[model samples]
Target: MGQLCLVAVMVGALTLALYVDAGRQAEQNAMERMRSLAASLAVNPFVIDAVQSPNPTALLQPYAVDVMDSAHADFVTIMQTDRTRFTHRYPSEIGGTFAGSIDDALAGRTVNQMQDGPLGPTIRGIAPIYSNDGRIVAVVSTGVTVENNNSQLLERLPLIIAIAATLLAGGAIVAVGLRRYLQRVTFGRGPEEIGQMYAFYDAVLHSIDDGMLLLSPGGELVLHNDRAAELLGLTLREGVSAEHSAATGQLPSELVSLLASGKTVENEVVLVGDRVLLVSQRAARTGGKAGSSLGTLVILRDRTDLRKLSSELDTVHTMADALRSQTHEHANRLHTMVTLVELGKGDEAVRFATDDLAQGQRLTDRVMESVDEPVLSALLVGKTAQADERGIELSIVTEGRIPSGLIDVHDAVTILGNLIDNALDAVAEQASPDDRWVEIELIASATELVLTVIDGGPGLRGVSPDDILRRGYTSKPGNGFGRGVGLALVTQAVRRSRGTLSVQDRATASEGARFTVVLPITSDANLNGNTAPVTPTPDRKAPQ
Candidate 1:
């Protein structure tokens, strides 16, 4: 990460330096050309216009022969203060407005290149034609064509390519070297298999499924495939105008600030009329010096349809769970009625059956009443069935609509699955048969999505909160790498969602554990895209 950051910073610094140098050179060139024109006019006072229409022979004879000098600009125009185009460069510009820095110069400010103009849109400076008493006579605006702007673009093109290409090429070369080194040093790759062991990542970069980008640490465009440019609203042209926009604009400030502060940041920047790009980046290095590598490959995944499909998938699972629970709940009620029929206590059994059925229906009504997210509601129903499967009573005690907007269907299902899995894992560990149960309470208020998963098992013991979310820390015996990645994955997933997850001994129950997860409720206002802070809320719980 540090290496990637450093490379990005260097690349940005170099680009800014190059731009400054180029801009300064262009400005200097404009001034020199202006000075030369003024000198020529002083020598022959008969010359006035900029295109040299009248000759030296006419200047010698005619009293005040107004001659336009030879000015090689994209477009040349002579206009009055009211912005009338006198004699334009192109026929198209004959009556166009001189509403640029030329007007400012007529009003006596040393204005340089204002807007698009004729030698095919030029960069120009205006100097007033002065008389003996310093009275302004006319404005002598000299400009070089914007078609000439291509020179600047060409000069810097190689540098842009070098910066972008270096990072990608470095990654490729380094991977190969690393693979070979590991084979030689640590038996990580076998002799026969090493040759066959190929680059899945090489294919990943070229895959058309998603557009890929490699960004410099400071968020400059680095290596991007053709698809990336299309996604990012960048030009398909390698022409002058395209190059101008590519290099001269101010970069997004938030991105630069993130990199400078040594943080790996990822977010979506809209392309105005293009795809909704989900840009995911990690701090990585090409592991080379300046001019040798560009740091950080930023991958852009087109998740528009993928996201919709994922949401649908989650909904399906939630509905399935809900259906399973409904089936089990009905079966249990019917079994009780059958037992009563065989016992011959008809009147009491009938009354008891009615009461029991009412209680069951009330539980269903209460669960279904407040929760509005159909997918989540279904998931809870399935979770109830899962509880029955494990011989434990599980219920969804939602106080309000399943926290709207903050979580999409997919994330909701994921959370539900993790909570249930953790509860099951806890229950499996309980040897003492006292209160072998699990409960999940989901409280959705206007402010938050509060989920509490409680299980009556050996309460989380001898695990430090600081280390609980680490990649490999598990409470299960043997410290084995094999069987303990589930809880860790859940922790990381929560962290990714910018939410908080905490585990504790159940507050209301003594013999079980409770994991409380609070995610800030997202409204429709913030839910249309990826505008989020990915910082994992520091586990504030003191170590147990």
Candidate 2:
């Protein structure tokens, strides 16, 4: 609408100007024609002879009428030096005084002016007729009336209309084109609406707690909030190109890949420094599903703290479930021993109880001696019970004492716990329960700690190790809601600790997989580990 109004104003102004200019040109042409006709008559030899004769009107009146008709002028008058008309368009008024100035004509001059005359208002030209002796004999005047001038101006009306129509059509086309362009660019928003939208968007972007990134189609950093900067550990400004950011090593390779792929992903775990972020990404389109790609939008949620809490909660639940199973098993054994003693089989009851005590005691003592960290020891104990409940043999072996503060407790749990759970799940799939087994090895050296979990079950079976490590890749069949992500979590935790993880077919077992992780733990002075690990109270009733 604004465009249309502007075009209308412009066309109207231009048309008015053209009309005014045409009127001026028409008036000029009329005046020039009249002046030329009057000058030509004043120089005619017949008019010069007639003007000096005794009866000049007899010869001049008819001649003046003929000239007037030929020149398309309203009137032509021949007058004396004293301004007495001798010849005129009206024969009866031939002797009447000419209603015009002839003083200049009498002074041997030619004049052109708009003046009131016998023919009402007119544009007239006057010229003096001089004898061969160069004395003024008479004057001739020719004019076109105001009405005739108007008729001449109307003659060019069609051309003026054509020009005006062309201008209007051109303006409308330009206006429509501009309107469509603006609509596409601005989403049909006016200046004020666009300004308001910008204000609202800025407020929302800054107010959001989650890290947000807006990229252009070319992957340039169009916008990023403060939270995004803090989470990504990047000092960024607007308009930073993607190449420059990647070259500067500010954006992590995972994030750069996501941006480049232009694929939509949700809740993807990305490890940046020591932070674990759950990133959600989608491509932004301008209009709708069919619209062109605008860019990719990424939202990052800091899941570091939540993951730690979840890890701890999972450990507690595992311990509780394991303790419950142990309680039930012990109760069943005690009942059997009581029945044996009641049946006078005290020797058998004592032997059976002693055997159970010895086996449980040795395993507990081994784990405590190998792992000084209480959380890991407790985790292993609980996992051992869970394995026994599922009829699978679980073994935990260690090369050296894993002292406290070797690695972050949460990272330790996320890595070791998930690996064990994954292994247990894998081995539980074996058809022969007696042949199923999972083993854990924690080797602590002066410079690093290596954790390995092996499972006896169907191996990778030609599946890529890298594919299994990606999120949402699970061998187990189900609804697949939370099917895959254990290994991904492990990967993220391993990366956070500046560690490495690898998966391969278990060489010891014909159909099993082995996973290994190496985490650096140099020294107290050089280590960039998290807070010191905390010791938990061990199960006092374990075979004691």
- The digit string of per-residue lDDT tens for model 1 on 103-154 reads 5556655455635644445666565554446555445455666556557556
Which pairs in model 2 have colliding backbones?
none
Model 2, 1-544: lDDT tens digits are 7777888888889888988998899889988999999999999999999988999988888888888888898999989988889888778888888887788888777989889876779999999998999888888999999888988888888888898889888989998998899888998898999999999999999988999998998778988999999999989766776767877887877677666777787877666776767788998887787998878889999877677777888789889979998998999999999999999999999999999999999999999886777888888999999999888888776776787767878878889888888888887888876548877877776677878887777878788886676542577786543446566678888987889999887455343888889888764733224222323212111110
Top-TM-score structure, candidate number: 2
Question: lDDT for model 2, on a 0 to 1 scale?
Answer: 0.82
Estimate TM-scores for all models. 0.38, 0.68
Tell me how many residue pairs clash in candidate 1: 17
Q: Where does candidate 2 have its weakest 10-residue lDDT segment?
A: 535-544
User: After superposition, which runs of candidate 1 have C-alpha atoms over 4 Å from their true positions?
Assistant: 1-349, 395-406, 472-497, 505-512, 524-544
